[model samples]
Target: MPYCPPDCSCNLDGTVDCGGVDLKEFPRNLSESILHLSLQNNALEVIPMEELSRLQNLETFNLQNNRLTSKGLPDDAFCSLENLLYLYLANNKLTVAPKYLPKTLVSADVAANYLTKIYPLTFGQKPNLRSIYLHNNKLTDAGLPDHMFNGSDGVGILIMSSNFLKYVPKNLPKELFRLHLKDNKLEKIPKGAFDHLSKLRELYLHNNYITNDGIDNETFWKLSSLEYLDLSSNNLTQIPRGLPRNIVLLHLEKNAIKSIPGSWLTQIKNLEYLLLHNNKIKAKAIHPLAFKGLKKLHTFHLYNNMLERIPSGLPRRVKTLMLLHNQITEISRNDFAYSYFLIELNLSYNKLTSPKIHPEAFRKMRLLESLDFSGNNLNVVPSGLPKNLHVLRLKENEINSIPDGSLSGMTKLKELFLSNNKLKLNSIYPGAWKQLTNLQLLDLSGNQLSYVPTDLPESLEYIYLQNNQISVISENAFESTPNIKGIFLRDNRLTTSRVKEIAFEKLKFLQVLDMGAYSESATESKKDGGTSGDNLENDSEQATQNDK
Candidate 1:
């Protein structure tokens, strides 16, 4: 029967909750036997030290989202709670690390504060401390004492990102498993900065100013357990030498790197994801055997570069290859000769035309699933696409016709996007989509169609035919497709008199039928009290909500 505060709730398990009550001061008459207390999301400006010291059995303290300042927190605010294991003082106005923290602290989150410095003995002698989150602070390199974490042998994760540190902090705990210093001003890594952190697994240093000359050759060679490293958005002109051989994921995008040496990554056999987009990498600068030994690499992103053709030696086991937004004009037969496991390939926004693309360019990718050839200059659909493809995007091209037998083998195709092309109703061959039994969506919007194309797949669920010159939808236009759910024929020349009610009679699952903005003359006919035009529009609207 312990006394609970008037505005708070108390549990029999020694937990008290008083968060988000617009509390301006700490609640009184709190049970001394309480083990957990929450006072977050309040305007608590000061912590009454003498009053809080009575709760010696308290193990977790949360004062996050308060107005606690450095001067208000006394030197012995949290030192008296001998059993304090978790402390959360984040989103406060503290200008320095709280001093005299109990040695029993396991995790402390002081993130999103105005902390500018950490005293020498702030986290020095805590052997049980494992995590310290001080990100989004204003701490500089000089503010972090060299021996800040001197005696803390068990500190594992330290997040100091979005700071103003100019150099890597020295004498870090040897048992660190993850360190995040991204969004900092780090310019150099002193020779032995990370030599002692043998158990470090992930290091994030992106959005910094680290150049190749500033990184010592042996800086990251001693981290045997390192697996993920991000050096994106930096000033490096080339790939830094002496990266850990066992790393799995490497991110080097948004750098000024121009060339990748042949032997740079030959030893990292465990690499899986490599991102090098938004750089100045040219096709000739990539050595013939640059990516020869990466067997486990599945995702490679080299888009937004100055490459005229596909690089010679891509990873053989890559499953997703993104080479869009480049100067690539053609795909030779041998470009993807060894990529047998590729599933998704995007070659959009390149200078590729139909004649420049070799017929056998994509012949070896039998397992391909999604192919995007959009934003190109092709007069017809490219041949030799994989039959197992499920999604194909040929939008924003000059494609005027689909040659017969071009898509007859792709039985598993599901979605086709041919919007914003020069396609007309007569340009599509008869039964062009006859073999596509699994097709679900067809997008032919922004085309030059005067009539709806016939012989659509029966499995179609959605069709987009907006932004065309279609003046009439034949009575049996959708007779072949019965499972269609949505039809977007907006912004066309469809009038009320031309639309027959029987055209949409068989679509039982239809939900949306938007025939946008009729002419003023059509609306005048409805105003003249004609039931023919009004009934036809009303019946089509009623069909959209059938069987729901």
Candidate 2:
């Protein structure tokens, strides 16, 4: 049996855990055969080199979330652990990386520290070292040498985000597969900075001050294996040239890009996700054939732009297209003629009106499952909505009525939000939602309703009628919605005597009846010879517990 410390737990498999014991110092008398030791989440400030060297067979050491500083760790602190494979020293006060690391180490995490510099040989010649995480540190370009990882030929992943580097580090390992330099002060990328990194697949350079002139034309042309590239939140006025041909996901949102010429994206055949929202892109500035060759593209986001109409030549196989918060006033019939595979469409917060939207605008979208047209100028729901839509949002509009047979084809609708409109009791057609057998949630709050609308779907589970003019709940108000679980009638004019007891007696599954602000309002209505004040208070309390 291995000896276990008084404040730690020891196992037969050479593992010791001493985490979160408020330990002020390192434990003593650890087994020499220990393979893993965890001292995280403690107050340990110093590591006894001689005592730690006794565990020659240790392979993993974790000192994360401790108070270890540079003075507590000597240059040769971990030199004797020849078999150490992983080391974690995150969340410390070290200003510099420790020197003379073991050659057998495979991974090192010194992130979330005060590290401002790293010696050239701090990592030594560890041939097996693969990953180095130094994020959330105070590292600067002057503290880093040109040949940072020259000895570690197998280093594949290096993360140095949130640093003060003014430019891309030079002489990185050619075998690097992923490099993260985001959230830095980088201003430019030299011509041959990444020419040797052919195996690089993911590069994150977002949240920097890089401009269009700061990048060379041939900077990223040689990265043939690159797949994911993020250049968002930059100062580029146009799309960069010479991107990798096989790139998959491209993020250029929150930039100053104004236009995309036809040749900018004609070479990227394997692109899947293209995010260009929050830019200054206009519809006419984009070439007609800008997205013609992207056959595998699925998601395209162009919201928060200056587009006045749908861009032509969208990806044929694109499934999600987000064009909200634009200046588009009309939707022509041929706008989406080739985008038949779209599953989700969001054109909300635009200048669209009822007559400007062609009646056959959405006729080709048979596979669309979600549609949002809220925050527009439409006075009524847009017709020609696909039958397979599962969610529909038309709130914050001027809609006042639901014409008969308008929504009779949406039998698969599950959630319908028509709140914040001008709807009234007599404006809605009777049995408008009778064909919606799969409906589950209906939102009609912030309207001009005088009474509960009859002919609600039987499959409804939740209803929102708050902030309306509702004053009565007839006995048959909820007769068709026996499966209802929650009814929100707060901020309405409902009184105790007007809300029949039988209206809530049949709702056995009702769990929430929000009638807040009703007591104060009902008291005023009762003073006008409505009902007895004592009876109104008693019935209101009983309605809240009907489910019990």
lDDT of 1 by residue, 164-195 (tens): 99999989999999999999999999889999
Candidate 1: stretches off by over 4 Å: 520-548
lDDT of 2 by residue, 1-548 (tens): 88887778888889999988899988887889999999999998999997899999999999999999999999889989999999999998898999778889899999999998887777647889999999999999998877778689798999999999889988888788999999999899987999999999999999999999999778899998999999999888888999999899999999999999998997999999999999999999989889887898999999999999998888889999999999999899989888899999999999999888887878889999989999999888777778889999888899998877779879999989888899987777778877888988888888899988888999998888767888888999999999998787765787766878788888999887765543445666534432233331233443322122
Q: Give the clashing pairs for model 2.
A: none
For model 2, the local distance difference test gives: 0.87
Candidate 1: global Cα-lDDT? 0.87
Task: Output the number of the TM-score-best candidate.
Answer: 1
Error of 1 at 311 (Å): 0.5
The models' CA-based lDDT, in order, is 0.87, 0.87
